[model samples]
Target chain A: MSTLSERILGAPHGNYVDRKVDRAYVCDGTGMLTLETWKRMGAARLSDASRLHVFFDHIVPANNSTTATLQHELREFACNSSLTLSDIGGGICHQVMSEGIVLPGEVVVGADSHSCTSGAFGAFSTGVGATDMAAIWLTGETWFRVPDSIAIHLSGSLRGGAEAKDLALSYVNRLWMDGGTYCALEFIGEGVKTLQMDERLTLCNMAVETGAKTGMFYADDITVQYLAAKGQTVRPQVPETCTYIRNLELDLGDIVPVVAVPHRVDTIKPVQDLAGLPLDQVFVGTCTNGRYSDLVRFAKIVKGRKVAVRTIIVPASRQVLSEAVRTGILADLVDAGCTIGTPGCGPCLGAHMGVLGEGEVCLSTANRNFRNRMGVGGEIYLSSVATAAASSLTGEITEPEVA
Target chain B: MMQGIGHAVCLGQDIDTDLVIAGRYLRTKDHSQWVAHVFEDLDTSIAPRLKGAVIVAGKNFGCGSSREQAAIALREAGVVAVIAPTFARIFFRNAINIGLPAIECNITCTEGQKIRFNLADGWVEAEGKQYPIRPLSPRMQEILAAGGLVNYWKARS
Candidate 1:
């Protein structure tokens, strides 16, 4: 009996194993460094150019000439090397990869920490540093110290305005930062089936916040349906009994909307505890909660109501953006006085597009709230799209009404 | 045994990678900018003091982001080593991959106190006390001694 990570890596807990990478990617911020390291290593011939991807999402449209030149160089490298490139506005790298590229039971590695987001699809995915990625580009393989697994058993279904983001916050609060370090969080139980693909992605996206190697759900019909919709088919993975370092059980029905307070993702509290707190801005997008379902939930909350504060809406990808446009969700958000930015990681990493100013506060749906992450001296509060939309309507941290 | 001595610089717990190098400076590959701006968020004065320094920090040091630039910045800034009770896994790997020693040990020392360490012996001496560290694997020690994974790989190839 083996956990998903052990099954994929063919190694037991705490053992080092080198496996061939099925997919490897890097964003612009890391891509330049990776390219430099590759050159430093004699520009060795790539092992598998087709499996490599370069995404420009962190700082899109060039924040300045230096960025523009670097992006231009990356574009040239991608083209010359025959690697896949997702240009500016293509959406976040993880979101784009999840659209159909990443399959179940494959080894996926990205330079960005959010790469673990793909583990939602049942792949053994994790993030590595840029130089490590450069080595992957050269050798097509990397080593991992197979982490022990922690089985998280979830039951019941979320209700009453609670969302996957809230559940994610709840789990992180329980685990605390670094509690799951060097461990794989295997989410399994009746509640796993209750979550749709978007929610599953949300859960896995925040795994890194716990300092975990990855968060994963075993592939089932929900996973099958999600891939099937994209014209791909996959078999459901049978659950096998495996030893876990720790076992945790969560009842989703008991969950309520919560927010991760400033400076730490694990500093969580129910939304009502911080209600009525004024906000300088509200952002609804990121790999964490920037999908079609998330936008729909956000639009449902703020529809036909004027926002009381500056709100930014960034779709996860071009596909998500066009779906919002085709379905009138974009119009509803725009009519509510929300500013639409390019479909990328907008102001999530304090890179560009609506970065918070000194002494400013923002309620965002993105993951991390680490100090100075969005901007120096600026505060970030993380929550669900529902909580973000509810807050935007009143210009304060507000909990959403039961849907 | 590869080892060195340097003045100690102390910091508290959970020092994240963003504080090591902000996203605003990531667009440029100029290593000097990274060295200059390292720890600017915490204190601009820390950068000037980093040269030949052994940073002794609390637990979970380098906790967020997988940016290798953080490790690069510290190495280029002439940091002799970083000693913490624990490290975020990715940062620990990045540090070793870049030839920056990330020692796992618990030690208390005042700022500017001279510190001595032995990587092979897995112990650090500060303020007339010796604290044993979790020894690195032979593979990791080889990479660090080779000045990083690139050089290690080059020698192998």
Candidate 2:
């Protein structure tokens, strides 16, 4: 059994000096890397500089000068520093980190906040800023307040239309905006065992919504097999005994597809509740929903149907992209009027690609729906792969009405 | 109470730790590295005026990402305490846990009211008037006196 509370935070880790961490790493979403942002690598003060991984899951092809600079800097940094670069269009930060990099019971921090996504594998991960990243890049030491813990046990399996995304969203919503603030969410119970590693990744990816420092699901066989297939070693973990602040009861039932209407993520309502909400754009890729299986679902829907006018599909990775092409999913999407593009972190950052003009409404699979998050004054409605697909066909929010 | 060092006032939100100290010069562990860029965002007059002070700001002032540097920066820069309408929840906990004397003081004035705060008296003096900054309901005050959250954790351990 591993007793590792002090690993990510407590004492000075390994041979590094006692460098205190300020807060936690919640993970910033895609498009840039920080270690090279300040050029602090292999400084032993920062434990295992190579431990800080980089992947281009957000943007496959750097579209402009600034983004291109970021990409080039990463390549140069990884090569010069002898660090492992995970993705050349990897699916998403969480999945890539979980499939191999992190071991059970370890504490991980990323420059991205959703680094909490790695918690699904039983290691604690969160994000932070670049300066902090620079410090962590130099010395893996960080300061943590040791947040209160919340335990949620899942009992039921997800129905067809529900997917892990909806359940994850509902969990945060149930917790309310500040419900889980300053807490570590531990998703336990037999229901969690039913989820595929990919599905579990989706569940933990949104842990940030409730302001949680991290969300966790213990690592099991699925985790080992995934790593084994990639020729990586897997570690074991022991459960935490800390009492949870709140324990939610979740049983999988036939959940009708749901959509989070704009302005705030928790303002979500059923898709039928989204009637008459006209949209100008539809985006289908993000750290949350851009994955191989997610694309396959889109392909299933759009293959026989036309995408809503102006709808676009951004696969989470080039690997997902190549897989889509080889699997015929890409051809199906374009056949349905969907404009497919390179796997770059797009409008999700509210910076580039698929931006909605003022007053335009967009149906997106990204996490936040804050004003101007995707586009200034433009509205974003959050939904799952099935709902995004169904809404793409109608140019309005709609549910698949399927299991 | 604003007792130890009179309350401070740092105007505006998103006053990141970098504004407290630019990244280019923070390679040391001593608080001495702080004075250079204490208020890089606002007027440079801040450091000189902060012989002892507390900060006052608006809602979600510490919104966005978390950087402990902000706390260390403020603490080292000599901010005795912080008073805001509402905080980002994290910073509020952080400032208090680290022994930075942060309190929640409801302000009636719309904006820009300069006043005096007596930590010894537990009063907030502004707009030619005086208001109590305490009445923290006991448990809250104990946490504040213990010197912020992490210190409390260390003491407990």
Candidate 3:
């Protein structure tokens, strides 16, 4: 009667347990800080360089000399330490790791809040700050106060144009921000089997929005299949019993296309309610919805139709970009009046490539909608790739047409 | 006895890390830039008042992003401590890892009101009342005493 975290941490809930890391990573944003902290600890070499990774996603291409210089230093460090480096166009750290790099039952840590995204693979993954990541790199281990678990049971299947992003928003709306603070959201039930690997990743990506330590599914057939397709053979690691602090249920059929309004991710409303609300732009990409399937969905919805708004589409990784290009999805999107950006985090954090102008409104497929996140004085409304494509057609928030 | 005394600088619930220090300013490692822009989004005038201030806010403080720079900014800006009903787990850990005290206590405080806290005793005294706080574990206390995790580890090694 223990949660996945408890089992992985090898302790009961609330007990501080020190565990070895199977994998750890940091992006450009946190990499420098982590490196600095690692050096400040007077350590010269990584405890295990093979298990660590460095990804360049955020502010890729270097926004200015300051970032360029820092990224340069990080590249040198990665080279010196013999660490795996995913340079520009490598995609987001979460997405890159999910490409069979992360396995079930592993203790994975990242230096970004969305590191919880890996929990979709049934790994006991969580995010930490730069210093904590440094500690992990130095010692190849870290401490965790085993988080209590919350059981989120899903029933029925998503319908009526509802994508995994909407289900994610629905749960976040129900849990509210911080409702799952210091807790693990264990997503279980038959509905988990209905979602594809992309959808599961999307659902787990926003786990941190609810303040969860992680949102995970047990490694079942679906997890096995996903990894198998990625060229891995693994046994399912389903638990016999989980002692949860509380149980919540969501019917996927009830999930409608929803958007998290500006300044807050939990402030959700149906797409129909906000329909016809004008937007300055529409963005489709991030660690959350920037996978190949999401791009394919956006292309299918907008095929042969011109976008009324300035639409920006970014592939989450170089591999995703290759798939989109090979499938003609990229061409279809370009023909549909959407501009394609480099395969990385594009203006998700308001860095570059498509930063929203002051006072502008954007319906984005990214995870966050916080104030000034996309640009100073700009407002971000987060929605599904389907809704983003539909909204791009009208230059306003629009409900996706049911397929 | 780890203690701090400062005037309260109150904020509302769900103070996100972006609001504490926006993503745009994170490209540089300049601590002063972060200090200058700390909470600049929430209130442009608040940064000047952060020095020696105790931030009393609603539940779920530091609710978004895992940017340790947010905690670094607050600490560099001279914030003595942050008191809230609850905190996003990562931010709380970041604050502690950086030697900034993050206290969980629902103490009603008005702006500029003198607030004092005793981490060892696990209580916050504000406006003629005392609120008990959840004490940090002995390990965390030891880390804080050494100024931060790096220093703590440095001393140990």
Q: Which candidate leads in TM-score?
A: 3
Ranked by DockQ from best down, the candidates are 3, 1, 2
Runs in model 3 deviating more than 4 A are none
Q: How well docked is model 3, in DockQ terms?
A: 0.85
Q: List the residue pairs that clash in candidate 3.
A: none
Error of 2 at A195 (Å): 1.5
Residue A261 in model 3: lDDT: 95
- How well is each residue in A152-232 modelled by candidate 1, as lDDT tens digits? 899999999999999999999999888788899999998898999999999999998888999999999999999999989
What TM-score does chain A of model 2 get? 0.86
Instruction: State the weakest 10-residue window (summed lDDT) of model 1 chain A.
Output: A36-45
Best by DockQ: 3
lDDT of 3 by residue, A1-403 (tens): 7788887778899998889999999999999999999999985658899999999999889989999999999999999889999999889999999999999899999999999999998899999999999999889998888899999899999999999999999999989998899999999887888898889899889999999999998888888988999999988876758678989899998899999998789999999999999999999999999999999999999999999999999999999999998999999999999999887889999889989888899999999999999999899999999999999999999999999
Docking class of 1: medium
Error of 2 at A145 (Å): 2.1
Q: Write the per-residue lDDT of candidate 2 for residues A1-403, one digit (tens) a residue.
A: 1213333444421222234332223222222324432332333243464465666654445555555665676677666666666545555565556546666667677666567777777776776555445545555565454556677778878786787778877886777545666567788777877888777777777876666777787777777776687677776555655455578887756345677775656666877777657778888887688788998887787778887668788876666788888988888988899887656456775655676678888888877675555555677888888888877888877777573
Model 2 complex DockQ against the native: 0.10
Native-referenced TM-scores of chain A, all candidate models: 0.99, 0.86, 0.99
Pick by lDDT: 2 or 3, better one? 3
lDDT of each: 0.91, 0.63, 0.92
